[model samples]
Target: MPRILLIDDDEQLGPPLAAYFQRFELALTQALRPSEGLALLAQGGFDAAILDVMLPEMDGFELCRTLRKTSDIPVLMLTARGDVMDRVVGLELGADDYLPKPFEPRELVARVQTVLRRRRTAAPAELDPDEWRFEGGLSIAPTRRRVLREGTEVELTGTEFELLLLLAREPGRVFNRDDILNQLRGHEAELYTRAVDIVVSRLRKKLEPLDAIKTLRNAGYALALRRLP
Candidate 1:
């Protein structure tokens, strides 16, 4: 069973949610405050995290940003109002997925499973070379899903790595927003178009000085670097 951490101030939320998650073979651990959650995460047994937007000690967005500085654990955020801007900010802050308040337990479980799936899927067999090198001293190891810039390891969130590989695989091929969303989260494409841009921006920042990606006015993005021989 994959271990999952839930950080929420609502004392009533964890027990029932944990019980429900067991039905899907996920072990749920609870933390009532951001500090507690951060401490628990520092201990490092969790496979993923579920954060409620209305958290104590710190809001989920700040917590997510702080977490990203040191770890790339997949994160799913819960928005109290199901607001679009809230979801967008969560994505921008490195959350792997988001859910609205008053959501169905089943839907939440499905979203959790989807993010986990995205976390594990490497890439298409044929394109997954042991490692790929680009012209600007950037290299990607498909098996480890790791990236290096000028031989220096560049830590990336799961979503960021996935988006990077997606563009790197095709080199110059342009991928529109819907195509990326469908690849990232098949069910969220229509509602989360801006998500692709968010991931692209995040990925670009992390792989700085390489100029690894290019965007055509309304056409979309592509890998700007050529493969190393």
Candidate 2:
């Protein structure tokens, strides 16, 4: 069973949700305080983490930032419904995905499963090369699940790496927001198009000097880099 940690201050939220998650064969552990959650995470053995943005003691964003300094464990953030900035900030903080409050447990489970899938598989296709080399010293090794920029290793979260891999597989192939959200999240979300833009912005920053991703006016985004000869 995959273990999951949920960091939320809602004292009444854990037991019932834990029971629900158990039905899916996922072991859910709840931490009512950020300090407690950080302690539990420090002990290790969690496959993923679900954080509530409104938590006490430095909030979920700070916890995520601190945790990211040491681990790449998949993260799903719970944001306030209708707060676009909340979702955007979570993604900006390296959250693998986000779900709004008042969400169905079933939907949350589905999102968690999608995040796990992303962590497991990132390459575009089975027949693609083990490593993809692009122009301007960018290379992605799918087998190793690593990216290198100009010969130096670049650290990317699972979501970021997966998006990059998707675009690199077919350089210049336009991937509209809906398509990207589907490919990456496994569900259609009308509000998540901005999520795509936020991720692209992050990728652009990390891939500086190369201008590796191009935005097509109202069409979509594509890998601007070409394969290395």
**Which candidate number has the best TM-score?**
1
Return the top candidate by lDDT: 1
lDDT of each: 0.88, 0.86
- Evaluate residue 45 in candidate 2 and report its C-alpha lDDT on the 0 to 100 scale: 96
What lDDT does model 2 reach? 0.86
For all predicted structures, in order, the TM-scores are 0.96, 0.89
Clashes of each: 0, 0
Q: RMSD, each candidate, Å?
A: 1.3, 2.1
Predicted candidate 1 versus true structure: per-residue lDDT over 1-229, tens digit per residue? 8899999998998999999999999999999999999999999989899999998788999999999999999999999664888889999999988888988989988988987887788778888889999998999998787899999999988888888888888899999877788778666544566888888998999899989899988888999999886
**Clash pairs for candidate 1:** none
In model 1, the worst 10-residue window by lDDT is 184-193
lDDT of 2 by residue, 32-59 (tens): 9889988999999998999999988889
Poorest 10 consecutive residues by lDDT, candidate 2: 121-130
